[model samples]
Target: MAQTLQEILLAPNRRPKVVEDVTKLVDSEVSDKSGVSGLAVKSGYALIKKINSSFVSDAVDSMLDNFVGRMEPYYASYKASGTGSFTEHLTANSSDVADALLGVTDDRAAGSRRDSVKKVYAKLRPQAKKHVEEALPRLGALVEEHAAAVNTG
Candidate 1:
């Protein structure tokens, strides 16, 4: 059987790199935004960062496993289909994928002790689905790259 996405991504040696890559992905996604909603995302992200220098990385590290778990079903479907790019598969199912990803953050935000973080999340939540959908291509590519690394290594 093929290794699960969680197993592949959360391996002890690979976890840190995965977290780093995820953090970069978040940075890229946030930085790529524009317009009013984009402004909101950027500002909310900036607020989170201002609260803690390592917040993004720490959040990525903490959320990586949940993120991978949320994505596993889509990954499995993509691998099983053996057709189209993972990016295409992800984009094709953008709503579910975005929801699944957001679910992780929603739960985290609910339990967060930092009211500032929760407030930022709430502010960003309204537009988050669109932003996350936009990110699916790069996110898929990142997952595919990691899957390839495991296959080749």
Candidate 2:
């Protein structure tokens, strides 16, 4: 029988590892300059690429904050069930993880912060979707590995 996404998500022992690996992979792939540049070019804002890159990076960080925040309760519930390492790791490195996920490097333009905020509103969803899609395959594989281990052991 195939496990559902919810089943995978709620699996106490496996979920943390799966989430950690998936998030890392997504962060690495989405934050790649080549990938962001491609997206900026597609947006027809290639000339303002630096600004757009900062906006995308900030947007992704915000998105990860929301995502990780939502997962906090789950983390708490599983805290004694072997998720302590992940919980501690997340607590210690969330900012770094967010930065990695966002791919932020240079500071946003001081004067254009307001404009970048406005642009990020328009770009957040699509960029989040792209990152999620990029991470899906690896996430699936992790889940499968967990399921296989559970079944055999």
Against the true structure, what is every candidate's RMSD?
1.1, 12.3
Point out where model 1 deviates above 4 Å.
Answer: none
Give the Cα lDDT of each candidate: 0.91, 0.46
Residue pairs that clash (backbone atoms under 3 angstroms), model 1:
none
Per-residue lDDT of model 1, residues 29-133, tens digit only? 999999988899999999899999899999999988899899999988988998998899999999999999999999999999999998999988988899999
Structural similarity to truth (TM-score) of each candidate? 0.96, 0.38
Best by TM-score: 1
Give candidate 1's root-mean-square deviation (CA, Å). Answer: 1.1
TM-score of 1: 0.96
* Index of the highest-lDDT prediction: 1
Residue 92 lDDT in model 1? Answer: 100
How well is each residue in 1-153 modelled by candidate 2, as lDDT tens digits?
323434444456655565566555544554552555456634533334455555444443434334444444434444445643443444444444444433321132222456654464345534544444444445435545655666566
CA displacement after TM-score superposition, residue 59 of candidate 2 (Å): 13
